[model samples]
Target: MTVKTRIYLVRHGETAWNAGGKFQGHSDIPLSERGRKQAKALAERLSNLKIDAFYSSDLSRARETAGILAEPHRGTVYYLPELREINFGRWEGLTFKEIAEAYGELSTRWWASPLTIQIPAGESLQQVVDRCTRAVAGIITRHAGETVVVAAHGGVIRVIVGAALGLDLNHFWQLRLDNVSLTVLEYHGPEKAILELFNDTCHLHEK
Candidate 1:
């Protein structure tokens, strides 16, 4: 019998850029007012669970969300810069429409072939996956057999989910992670992993 490591993957609460449909890669943007409420609701929902440890992106949005979630669990949040969102370069703070209008084919090609095209002055998708994987690998190895919570950005979470499932990077973009949503990954050993839940936002609907 192999000991399992259950991971509660959480996307951070909404930020202004998220609401505005802007690319927030590595911007250190803080969450909006409603974002706090969303985090609180999720916190209340997970408060009863036996979350053994908490890890989060060092960005303010993810850090703050993880802090709220970790409050009732009585765990210190270990910040990981490697878990930060992909660097979008000049695309930061700009909407996709804006980027398209400005950069035209470059932006369009990026949306169509993200893995092949590199963003001007920014890190590539592969770079994002590399560092995020490094962070998650360390987290999983250190906390095996424990239920751990990882609060991070959507891009970061998507990278993790893609890596876990051995899915192609291009197809990984199809995964939609809403604000404060929870996805779970259960690892039965070094070779077997299962996605028990994905993008669950029921906790956000609490009265």
Candidate 2:
């Protein structure tokens, strides 16, 4: 019998750029006002869970969200730079429309087949997968049979969940993760994983 490892994957709360539909990429953007509220609500909802560890991306937005979520628990957060979002490079801070207008073909390819498209001077989907996988694998190995929380960017969360589902980089866009949303994944072993929950926002609905 194999022990089941559970991970509560959370996308950091919204940033000013996120609200504006701008590419945050690896930029160190802080959370907006609404994002802070969302994080508080999320913390309240997750306060009851028996989480053994808390991890977060080194970015400010993710780290801030993780701080709120960690308040009810041990109040400790381990930062992992590898869990940061896909580096959008030149595209960072640009809105969707601006990106499309500036880099037409590249933007089109990005939406159409993100796995095959690499942003100008930025990291590729394969790179994101590789690093995120190593970080996730390490987390699972260190805390086998326990539940842990990982607060990261939308792209990183999506990739991590996709990898856990055994999906390749091509299917990356299939999973959508909203800000402050919760996704639960259980790993039976390196080869066996299950998606118990995906993009759960019920906590945000609570008063």
Candidate 3:
């Protein structure tokens, strides 16, 4: 029987920037109280699953969310900078409207063709795809037939999913991943994988 490795791709809980519609990029913002509550709810949702490993962006938001999710299983989270969000460069704390006003057509062009345009000091979508995929590749190699949890930022998770499905990087924007959402990818081999779930936030339902 060919064993497939299942990866629970998660977006970190909400942050102040997230609530304010600011670009978090590589900013090291921590989760808010609501974000922590969201993480707790997600943790309860996955408490019964047999998770073999846990990975997360080195950012405090993702780190804290991973910590909460792993609390039930006694899992140690492997933090990686590569799993961090697309470096928004100089636009780290600005909203999209602010970016558009400040950057003019450049921002519009970037939104339309992210793969081709570089973000002033931030990373292009292609560059993000390269590094994030490399990191996930290593994780899949180490645990070929097991299940793992990868908690990261929304943009990072989108690119990883885009690459997995062989979609153009531009489509990354179209894939809307909610904070603390669950997205699963099952990999049977390096080139063979399946997106079992995407953006499942059913766990956030009112208690």
TM-score to native of every candidate shown: 0.96, 0.95, 0.98
Considering every candidate listed, which one attains the maximal lDDT? 3
Tens digit per residue, CA lDDT, model 3, 69-97: 99999999999999999998999999999
* Clashing residue pairs found in predicted model 1: none
Q: Summing lDDT over every window of 10 consecutive residues in candidate 1, give the lowest-scoring window.
A: 187-196
**Ordered list by TM-score, greatest first:** 3, 1, 2
Question: Tens digit of lDDT per residue, candidate 1, span 1-207?
Answer: 788999999999999999999999888999999999999999999998998999999999999999999999788999999999889999999998899899998887887777668999888788888898788778778988999999998988888888888988866679988999999999876456889999999987745
Comparison by TM-score, 1 against 3, better one: 3
Q: How many residue pairs of model 3 clash at the backbone?
A: 0
Candidate 3, position 122, lDDT: 91
Cα lDDT computed for each candidate against the true fold: 0.90, 0.89, 0.93
Comparing 2 with 3 on lDDT, the higher-scoring candidate is: 3
Q: How many residue pairs clash per model?
A: 0, 0, 0
